[model samples]
Target: MANHPDQPAFPFRRPNPLRPPGEFERLRAHTPMTRVTTRLGDTSWLATRYEDIRSVLSDQRFGPHLHGGAMGWVGEARTGDSLFQDPPGHTRLRRLVSSAFTARRAEEMRPRVREIADSLARAMRDAPRPLDLAAWFGYPLPITVISELLGIPQEDRKQFRAWSDTFLAVSDETLAAAAQAWSDLNAYVVRLIADKRSGTGDDLLHALIAVRDEQEDRLSESELFMMAISLLVGGYATTANAIGIGALHLLHNGQLGALRADPSRVAPAVEEVLRQQAGGGEMRRVAREDVEVGGVAVKAGETVLIPLEAANRDPGQFADPLAFDIGRAPNPHLAFGHGIHFCLGAALARVELQEAFAALADAFPGMRLAVPAEEVGWSVRLLDEGPKGVPVTW
Candidate 1:
């Protein structure tokens, strides 16, 4: 792809594993809101500054819905995911899911999360030689928790993970695979919803189904299917990646010893990890109208890409942004994003991370990377970036 003179190419490469692309820093310093050519060859405004990114996300002028109310989804209109919806629709769907993801509800799951984490840690400790922490612990912990919460059968969880992997894959080469995954997941969710409708259970899916059946205009059948997919996608990939990346940060910076020494720091340490290890491609939004951002005029219909990783590291937002300090106070990072679109599963992710880290710290105090640091592979294919596998042993 040829780069325009005024626009740098989108998806800039990350030269350093610990920081965002050097180009992001350069862009922030010079042109905070410059044009960039997207992978799809569309020109979009790339927002890198902390304030600018927040404005773009918070402003109603920039919406997730594209022109003519059409979304990126393959099939019919009503079946579109809420992530791609705007205004009243987004508001309604968010309301339906928000009740289930309340802070109290998430807090109630902490003990259960700790139990799952402890079980994974024990398994990791007993495994022969080196084990991939991500495969053994990071991935399965969240999958199990979400599975139990959503009432998915234990036998079906692995297939869900595979579908999730494909859906979140970042490459053009994986487009067909992603589509197939979407079809498979959609069909499975439809069947799951039907099963739940037949007999209500204590699971969140059953509760949602009840709401759909009893409440008027609360949730449509299409929305129900998309909601289940959203919950699975939103609740799974990001948490799994965060766990893997957070583990790497702790191991690399000798923070594991600190965490083991004082497990009370696990919570704050998780926050620091969230801040430092926030890695993902830019978020996409289309301008609903002409808007001025960081003194640059964005015309209607123009796509805007907010680089969260860069915004989280802006020096204006955090002192010594590059340093990995767990105790950094007043940290308002955009790892979970900003504004109304802020992650609904933020509380749950925090609980899972806190418990997972605490359990790992307690279980494998002497853990070290089994492979050389440079040899550790990352998942370039996924929208969220993290170690493909963290091979480690005590």
Candidate 2:
């Protein structure tokens, strides 16, 4: 089939592994907002400029709940996904969960996070040759942290992985299986909430229940359950990918020595990693009304897809955007997104990533990829981007 402008040039290509060389520069040289077909057979307006993306994200008109309306499956959800909410509703849900992710609260979790990272690092250090860091360190640390936070029993994590895998998979077979997974997951969360009610604990679920029934302050059972899912899924998967991929990048780019020499550099390195990582897919939006963004007229109901990876690397916004620079000051990257929908767990993600990289660099200063970079396995259609396995050895 001839390549369609709307369809990514390589539909089956893994997101991070097949990132088009100089994609952002090419988009910037062109104009913003091109018509593109999503993997799910929907047409969307692709927004590439940084300013335009930020505006569209903050604007109330292009909502995340487009699926709930008459649009059907525009490949975006109306409910069950907190990212798809609009104002008042979005505000309410955000407020309810804000306490769990505040800077202070995340900071308080730092010691525990570090302990988790270190334990995983030690395990990796003592493991056999050709260790897959993604499975060993990257996946387990965040999974452990989020499971502990959600009060999920360790025994349930295996099922959690199966459900989450089905949830993120975009293939027809997996898509067909997701509804069942969703049902099972919702039931599981409901039971967890009930358990929290009967036996009080310090976890966020208990904290949520404490105030769930106040007048003008409450979360529906569905909302609470879904929000918890969002935290667990978003919290664990995204950071895990970043840690694994960031470690790979540092190893490949010959910067692990620099990071080891000065652990403080891990902070800036995390930001750069966020800037460089290719997110799994574009952020989807629809025109609330007639809007002119990036000199393009977008009519109501037209879908807009903002590629954060592309925008973060737009040369007009970041000098030498393609080159990863840990010292890139005034970075202003949109990796965490922008506006009211800005990431609530960003502070926690950063702390985990910093601790992870610092510990990894210090422990295995001689670490190198066990295979060629191109040999790393990549799954194209996931919600978060990274290698399926990153084999490394010191």
Candidate 3:
């Protein structure tokens, strides 16, 4: 792939905290799939338009695994998890854990989710004014939910949070920390699995253990460990960030008042939040063979980065794409992604977000940001983009 001098650099940061980077819209209008330099100074094709991004993600020809054993961004290597797996391997792995994250299961957990959210909200209400919602409510809600579902002990939840933070660090300076977190998480999972083997529990981890024991040929110990780690990390971080960002959006747009007046609006409000909050990290894929994206020929072994934020805001796909209309109907955002690799925890995340926002609306209808919107810090370490600390007062 030849680098175009006019092409904006890859991994573009949002000029405004709440909106997609300006370069994304410019790229979407001009060159949908253009060559650009990554943060590591490596050239790759960036797919900006909705149709092109969907094509790249849905098509099997563009797999997550890359040549030279690279996966996604530079310095990121392929893990044995399902994220990097393709075809039969991916299918097999997904099948073993799919039952635990099904829509029905997520729905079944709704009451518990509401309970957790309300409890957290009450705790926030009891605390002093100008509290950090991200620390008190946003992170803990999902962390507790996922931990309970996975049967992880409450005492160990903080360690998991720390490990996940380091594991998702994007900068080269934090690469060592990420690696250490990866090692520590794996070791922890191994120990957890060993503990589960000796006794049975009523959690997802125990169910996975049963499958590994009864169907030894189907699931391996290493696969089980990686799957556990994936569920723990992926399950918590994305939802936590979404809750913080979504709350910020509500507080900014006065949507919380509307939600408080009519609580039923929480569902659509959550969907709209998911749509507008789509700007985060990039999804990576490498061409398995020669493929054309947006009329540009992408050769095999070339990297393709799908900008979810750009695709979600494509004018062709969304009307008034940048607006935060809570009642927007027929919203088909690709925040969870598309096709086979679509997020497995999407339903669970939705439940958590819905309950979270609903609880906040009910508990504190007068909640407002304690600081100026611009004063809130955005996380630079993690892949997801959202407020690092949402300071709120009611």
- Best candidate (score: lDDT): 3
Candidate 3 positional error at 357, Å: 0.5
Put down candidate 1 lDDT per residue, 1-394, tens digits, no spaces: 2456566777887665666778888889988888898666667788889999888888988887332211244454643555556768888889887877888999999999999999998888778978899999999999999889899999999989988787666356666777788788888888888888898589989888888889858888778777888787778788988898888878877788888899889888898889876565656778888989899888898778887888888998999988888888888888887778888999999999999999998988899888765578867644577678888888
lDDT of each: 0.81, 0.74, 0.83
lDDT tens readout by residue for model 2, 200-293: 6877777777666453245775566677778877878888888877877887788888999987788899999888777735557777798888
Where does candidate 1 stray beyond 4 Å? 1-6, 65-83
Backbone clash tally for model 1?
Answer: 0
How close to the true structure is residue 136 of candidate 3, measured as C-alpha lDDT? Answer: 97
The parts of candidate 3 lying over 4 Å away from their true place are: 1-7, 66-78, 81-83, 278-280
Clashing pairs in 1: none
**What value does the lDDT take at residue 38 in candidate 3?**
71
What tens-digit string does per-residue lDDT give for candidate 3 at 17-72?
Answer: 77778888888888888888776566788888999988888999988743231123
* Cα RMSDs, all models: 2.6, 3.3, 2.3
TM-score of 1: 0.94
